[model samples]
Target chain A: MHTLALIFPYAVAFTVPLLAASLGGLFSERSGVVNIGLEGLMVSGSFTCAVVASRMETVLGPGNPGALWMGLGAAVVVGALFSLLHAFASISLKANQVISGTAINMIAGSLTVFLARTMTGSGNVRIVLGFIPSDIPVLSGIPILGPLFFTKTYATTWLMAAVLAVAWFVIYKTPFGLRLRACGEHPQTADAAGINVYRMRYIAVVLSGALAGLAGGIILVTYSGEFNGNVAGLGFLALAALIFGQWKPLGILGATAFFGFAATIANVSQVIPQFSRIPGLLLKAFPYVVTLIALVLFSKSSQAPRASGEPFDQGKR
Target chain B: MSRFKNLFTALAAVVLGLLAGAVFMALSGSNPLAGFYYLFRGGLMNMERIGNTLASATTLVFTGLAVAFSFKTGLFNIGASGQMLMGGLTATAIGLSVQMPRMILLPLIVLAAAAAGALWAAIPGFLKAKFNVHEVVATIMMNWIAYWTVYYTIPAYFKGTFLETESRRIPALASFRVEWLTNIFRGSYINMGVFLALTAVIVIAIILEKTTLGFELKAVGFNRYAAEYAGIHVPKNIVLSMSISGILAGLAGATYYLGYAVNMQIGVVPSAGIDGIAVALLGANSPWGVLASSLFFGILHSGKGFMNAMTKVPPEIGDTIIAIIIYFAATGVLFTRLWERITRKWNKEA
Candidate 1:
């Protein structure tokens, strides 16, 4: 196999979670809520998915694929429900967006660890339903793409690709997208135009949570073999990707892929002689270095929504 | 009355946070009163316990001051952990390499740590001021960069004899512990770090309350465009503000790695950095408020272990209880509004 082929699988795995989570951020930020708690949401979702899948695996016999999907579904619901706290704090209570988001992070992280300790008894949770690849029927026959794209890939990758497509359409072409963007850019004007700005924001935030939850689920069943009560700052990295992507779905895909590619190189450096000479720690830090440089280079007038972090108040304007 | 609202809200938050923890303790099948009693008693049982609690709080004081200072300037310094790491790493690097008199060497190492931390934080501050990068994302990215920097630096330079995960222990001369203070505290880890923290508190209080520079920074935080209109040099102040915040956190790192623990550990951002935000929020971002809250948090962190040992509740549950307190504390604005509504209703009835 070509070197790129070996690296492609892991890169795709890395891309899936970051891309999904950033898409979640895109939805929330586009509707004017800054969802910094994406990390917490991802963590809770990962734990929920892992625990559910593990229990189901025990009952349904090992290697049952349906159990994985069921876990993913549960994760989506849990993530959204968890995020409602953030939505309520930031919206109705008019709390500081940053504080509210971080509070959610603290609560989610500690709560999951506490529950897992009580439920699992060993203070950790792991699942044995691993991601083993099977070749797609005809797509596996394609020349260079066959081995790289279609061989031994998990079903979750295809699911993410489908999600990206739908997300792009929903956020770009749909009427709902227009209203969401309007809510973020100018909630007062959006309200004047008969858009229910608050309602739109709520929907956008909830949708973001659902997608982020899916990202967490994908990470557990694919990238990492076990859930460790951590998405390990992937949520924050996703936020970086969201900002880097300029808060557009297509741009987020590109940004997340770039980060995913950096992360893949870091983890696989021991196998590649060219990268082997560099310290392993530097390689681990490579993605962050890349992110910082990208931020510095592109930090100009971040095309963020004008009213991004402010609470919308109809009375004030 | 509204002038004292922030203080009132913070007090309410602390009380509510404790109540929430008590509720969790009750649910966990432990007596809430006993839990509270153990929690406080562990921190105040003896001179040694008091010393240890204060020693633990020493880092929180600096990190809280760092966060609160940055909050005043309208920037979120999420990279305080990274700054702390850099400070600790620099101090450790100095302690490992230098052979000099204690008086000269200590101040030199402390300055080096502060400079490194300030430089680390200035990157995000500069980016935010010059290019419009959001500090939250940029600082988080900086954190990983700092984390990896320590990960690489420690093993390459000061690897311990047994543990690959931490640096070699600092010699006694470079250590923050003084023989007299340790004896006075009955062999607790208490050191001169607490004094350093107190001095920092006073200096920061003066800076925030009595200086034009502080006023400029606060104005910029309140409204950037308006500050710009007032010719306050907003960009300069942003960088300066972050630099100051970083310096404080770096001091924390000095006390933490050099004073609290003899060796620096790899692959973990200091939890004190995030907890600092809660301390600042509960403190209402005042210098003295931050100090008070840091001490409160210190007791919770230090006493948590004993609470677990005495009660049936696990360590994770104890940590969760602390998290619940922080969550409620950070949601001060929500409670503030609630407080305001109740007050209005009371006045209407009266």
Candidate 2:
């Protein structure tokens, strides 16, 4: 029970970001733009959220709940706007998607670090917000389930779950979903069938940017409660989780849970007797190792979208 | 006409990037002219700074070569970071462990580092060649593995003290330093590593331009189907190209550790692997081109601190500049095509 207790918070926290990013990835990939810049978007979003939330605390006397929402809104807007760079490079310019994506990653990384340093008057800042966990009246009394599912988990976790459910429905059950998938499978074919491949891809990539940004925001306001250069790499780990989940929303949820569990173990390993002596870095490396193994095993069987990383060319097609 | 168009396109990208940077500076309330002045002066003014630039450029040279080698074979070797880390660690181990003469020890340490990098990169190369797995994701995952493994192993097996995470310094005999270069620069860390990097560029140029193996690799890169039909072993060439690329990346780490730092300390050495990508990309993934690009990047990096010292601008402005430069460089060719099309359309109308 105690072990479960130790693992659950991390599991919930990890899922929020992973699910959001994976859904974002799905949308973008479905619309035929492979978004390797998801990590950069997340970092930008995290920085925006942290800075906004901290500034709000300063302005609103530290106890305003609306500060968090404002930060979330700021993150989404920043994320969406940044995605425009990728859209312009990939969709409009018809550049190599990987290179453009990598450029975005570099730009985001430098810009975020620069902004954070400038904003905080130092290299680091603690983001303060007024969202403490308040128990639901009747639901709070349920012994194990309440704590595991509801009581201690941040509102973002529930939000992620809702987002995932909506994503699943929108992606798999709707007409727009069919068009998006068709665009990924064969953009020329989709175009011939009267679909706007460019517009769809642009929308998908933008949505991905927004979700990645939201994930970044959640990490800042909920889990770490601070923003630093460390969080920049989490988006990459989320990318790993996206692949490990085999690019499915449900699969990604499970993969994130596993990684989250590994993260929790690494975090609390010092408390555990036998694992304490092992270097914490090695334990921390577990999820990456698992991801590598999973990729090695499944890559042969995995079927990526036909137009995964290729920029669409109307004339060439 | 095509040459003129290409030059114009490249100039336009440079102009656009500068404009964007100027806007950013203005938004941040900094004087753009003062910032550019600091950047230009810091990078080019004095002898000590030039030596510092050369030292950093030497490291970038190896990384650039590594990236270019794989790119010529039509592979994006994103695992260069992991390979470089492994190379550095292995070279440090050799440098610390060996008691041989300088002539033997220096080459041996470098060779071992190259091998370590090659072995590390081979995992992804093999996966991509054998299983048709995308190298990008695999290489990225490999990077995380290498980083953590190196981080963990460094403290566990090579800890020199109870408190410090760094290993013991390399023995003096195994180190590579140029006395003349050091004298000229008045005791800067500039060494024979720059010559070695130049030699590598020459060797890569020869191999890429003059060899049958290079032809095979290029054929595979140009079109795998055509290469296979031409009786070239596609998978073998892919693996070999990646291995060679990895070896160069590793050699970069080795040179930095054995010739420059003389000690392997976690988080102290900048990520030569990631920086190598920028160097390679900016060089247009050409061997000679990479050499020139690396020198430019090295100058910017080495002068960043000097710029901060001389002016009120932060060192991160250098990173911003580098990022913008790389972004423009990556899309420079595309911009050229767009420019050509626009010019042709105007010419037709006229």
Candidate 3:
């Protein structure tokens, strides 16, 4: 019961960011553009949100919801703008998607560090507008699970879940979603059918940027309560979750939960006597190892979108 | 005309990236010219700095070759970081334990590091070849595992004291110090490692340009189905390419430890391996091109401290510059193709 209590909060916390990134990924991959720069986009978003929130506190005082929303908006804008680099390279210039994605990652990683060092006068920045839990009278009264899962859940978690539902509807039950999937599976066929493959890819990549940005914002505002160099690698882990989930919306949510559970175990194990001797680094690395095993086991049978990484050339195709 | 247009496009992309970087510097209230001055002067002002840059570049050359080698076989080996880490740890272990003569100890330790790197990379390679897994995903996941394993193993098994997390100092017998060349380089860190890196480049170049293995790898990359029909074992070539690439990356780690970081333990988290990707990309994954690119990155990296001292700009500016260079390099091919198309359309209209 004690372990379960400790595990639940982290699982909920992990879901917020995971769903955002996976949805962002879904948007891109569904439209025939593979967004590998999801990690970088998240980093840029997280940093921007943290810095803006911090600055806003100094100007507007501590408890400003307006400032927080503005910070979130800033993150979305920055993420989308930076994603244009990937869009230009992969969609317009027809470069290797992986290389372009990795380039974005490098740019995001370095730029954030550089900006943080300059603006904060230090390598790390603390989050200021901390999200306090709002309790509904009846829901907050429930026993252990209430506080663990719902009562303490941040606004972002609820928002992400809502977004996931909308994403599912958009992806499977809408005309836009059909066109996006058509673009991914066969851009040439989609082009012949009058869908603008390039335009769809651009929109998908930009939307991916925004969601990844929101994931970054949620991490800084809700989970870490700070921004630092540490979050750079988490984006990559999210990428792992996307692949492990086999590119499905709900599947990615489950994969993220699993990873989150692993993280919580590593964190909670510190208090338990039986697992105290295990090095924290090894435990921290558990999700990555699991991801490796999952990829090896599932990749043989897993199928990616047909035109996933390939740039669509109208003339050639 | 199209070739000329393509060249101009590539040049323009590089210029635009640098211009954007310069704007960033201006926004940060630093003089771009001053920063460039410090970058160049600090890198080449003294023999010692030059040697340091050369030494750093030597390792990057091998790692770049590693990345480029796998790329030729149509694989993206993001596991270079993990492979390099494993190699460094293995080399350090051998360097401390071996008591043989210098000639024997040097080769033995180097070989051990290479073998360890190859073994580390082989896991992803084997998985990819056997299961048809995407190398990018597998290699990246392996990188994280390698990072954790090295982080834990070093501290648990090799720490000298509670405060220090590094292993014991490596024995002098196993060290690959070239005292005479050090004098010629004006007491810089340059040593036999540079020669070894050059040799590796030459050997790789020969294999890629002149050997059957190279042809097999290229054929697999060109089209796996066709290669299979042509009697080439695509899976075997993929595995072999990654293994060889891993070995090269391992050699880089060993050389760095043996030549410059002697007696010092590597940091709990590694940086050199990650930086190699930037070098490899900037070099366009060409052997000779890698040599120049690695040296350029090395100079930029080593000169950062000097730049900070001379100018108020932080050392991280160097990283920003390298990141910009990589971004441009990654998209250079794309910009070139775009330029070619535009020019051809314009010419036809004319």
Evaluated with TM-score, which candidate comes out highest? Answer: 1
User: How would you encode candidate 1's per-residue C-alpha lDDT over B1-350 as one tens digit per residue?
Assistant: 76467777877777877787777677767798988888888788888888889998899899999999999999988888999999999999999999999999999988999998899889999988888778888889888988988998898889998999999999999999999999888988788899999999999999999999989999999999999999899999999999999999898898899988989999888988888888887788899998998898888877877777787655665456556666666666776788798889989999
The CA root-mean-square deviation of candidate 3, after full C-alpha superposition on the true structure, stands at: 2.9
User: Which of 2 and 3 is the better model by TM-score?
Assistant: 2
State the lDDT of candidate 2 residue by residue for B1-350, as single tens digits.
86566456545655666676666666666787776777767766777677778888989999889888898888988788888888988987777766888888888988899999998888888988887777877888778777777777777777765446787776677776667787887666677888889999999999898999999998998899999999999999999999999999898888887777767777543466767877787666778878887887787778777766775566676677667766776677677878878898999999
- Considering summed lDDT, which 10 consecutive residues are worst modelled in model 3 chain A? A127-136
Best by lDDT: 1
Residue A300 CA error for candidate 3 (Å)? 3.9
Q: Which digits, one per residue and each the tens of the lDDT, describe model 2 over residues A47-124?
A: 888888888988875736678878888998899999888888888877777777777877887777766666655646
Residue ranges of candidate 2 with Cα displaced over 4 Å: A134-137, A230-232, A277-282, B1-12, B160-163, B267-269, B338-350
> What would the TM-scores of all predictions be?
0.97, 0.94, 0.93
Chain B TM-scores, listed for every candidate in order, come to 0.95, 0.91, 0.90
DockQ of candidate 2 (2 decimals): 0.58
lDDT (CA) per prediction: 0.86, 0.79, 0.80
The residue pairs that clash in candidate 1, if any, are none
